[model samples]
Target: MRIRPVGAYALLLDCDDPDHVEAWRAELCRRRDAGELSAVEIVPAARTVLLDGVPDPGRAAARIAGWTPEPVTTTAAADRVDVPIVYDGEDLPVVAGHWGVDVPEVVQRLRDTEFRVAFCGFAPGFAYLTGLPEGLAVPRLATPRSRVPAGSVALAGPYAGIYPGASPGGWLLVGRTALTLFDVHADPPARLTPGTRVRLVDA
Candidate 1:
């Protein structure tokens, strides 16, 4: 792991892997909750976590350097969320072609594989899920759509994601769920947060 100063108050922890980054983020959040660490925001990404509003960047970096990260599999059971999907997307055939499989096989693969939310970005309530098998990785669409409908389950590169709401997108759509992924009235608007386990199943 590597720690670097970001501007004046933020410190970024560059982890060896995506799992390590999540472990570090969780530890920092625990400390923050117990009044051990003063952090305004703890943002985790694909392979890094940003600690913002830190009083002493050097001291924070030192603490993190000494902290040993835990294995990623230790995620709590409460973090798991299953999303039911209907495999009737416009790009299903395209995705099958890319994977060298039939449409039914593509659906089966989604049902069998487990995925985790790596990070949330691009839009509010939009979670980028990882854990797709290497063989299933496919490139994004050559041209992005002007507007993609909400609840559009899609794939791009090594990540699988659902469009929380109508917006512009480029990822190839494979399926969609009826579950409301985002709710403005809810305490936490996003249904999928970082480290949350996600399973896509046939509706």
Candidate 2:
């Protein structure tokens, strides 16, 4: 891991991978809640975590450098969300071909996998989820759609994502859900924040 100052009061930790980032973020969040670390935000990305609004970035960096974080466990029942989905996407056959499986097998595999939110990006409440095995990774479309409808469940590389709003996207659409992923009027706008576990159920 490489730690760099982001500004006057923040530090960005570049980790080895997404799993490493998640582990560090989990530990940092635990410390913050336990009053062992002081920070306003602990934001995670594809391969990094940003510790923002720290009182002393230098000291915090030194402290973090000496600490070791364990792997994150996502077995908490409270953090799990079940999303009802209709597996009738335009790219469903394409995905099945890529996986060398039939359409029904594709749906069964998706239902069996437990996904975790790695980060949020692209648009509001759009979460980049990780959990699909590396071997089952799929490629993006050769050409992106001009407009993808909201709640489109898609897969790209090793990540599974849900389109939060109607927008242009390149990911392979495999299913769709009706759950409101983002709501400005809600207490916590995004339903799938980082570390939240997700299960896609057949609707």
Candidate 3:
């Protein structure tokens, strides 16, 4: 792990991998909620956690350096979301060919996997979910679509994602849901925040 300064009031922790990032983020969030750490935001990304709005970045960095994070376990039931999907994407056959499996097998595998939100990026309410085994990782499209409809469930590398709005994207689309991923008028705009567990079920 490496701690780098992000301005005078924030610290960016570069973790070894996504697992490390998740572990550290959880620990930091726990400490902050318990009044053991001071920070305005504990944002997590692919392999890093950003501790922003710290009053004393130097002290916080030093403290964090001495700490070790454990693997994350036990997600609260309320944090789990079931996204209903209809698996009839244009790239469904392509994905099955890549995996050397039948189309039905692809859907079954997806349904069996329990995914977790690693981060949110690309666009508003677009959560990058991780859970697919490394061996099942898929490549991005050679040609990205000019416009992907909102709620498109897609996969790229080892991450599964849902397109929150109509936009150009390179991820392999496999399914879609009717659930509103982002709503400006809602209390919490994004439905899949980091650490939330997700299950994609048949619509």
lDDT values for all models: 0.88, 0.93, 0.93
* Tens digit of per-residue lDDT, candidate 3, span 1-203: 99999998999999988888999999999889989899999999998999999999999999898988889885887889999999998899989998999999999999999999999999999999999887888999999999999999999999999999999999999999999999999978999999899999999
Report the C-alpha lDDT of model 1 over 1-203, residue by residue, as the tens digit: 88999999999988877778778877888788988778799999988899999998888888778877666784666778989999898999999999999999989988888898888999999998988787788888899999999999999988999999999999999999999999999978899988789989778
Once fitted onto the true fold, the runs of candidate 3 whose alpha carbons sit more than 4 angstroms away are: none
What is the lDDT, from 0 to 100, of the residue 170 in candidate 2? 98
Stretches > 4 Å off in candidate 2 = none
TM-score of each: 0.94, 0.96, 0.97
The 10-residue segment of model 3 with minimum total lDDT is: 70-79
Clashing pairs for model 3 are none
Error of 3 at 93 (Å): 0.6
Give candidates' CA RMSD values in order: 1.5, 1.0, 1.0
- TM-score, structure 3 vs. true: 0.97
Among all windows of 10 consecutive residues in model 2, the one with the lowest summed lDDT is 70-79
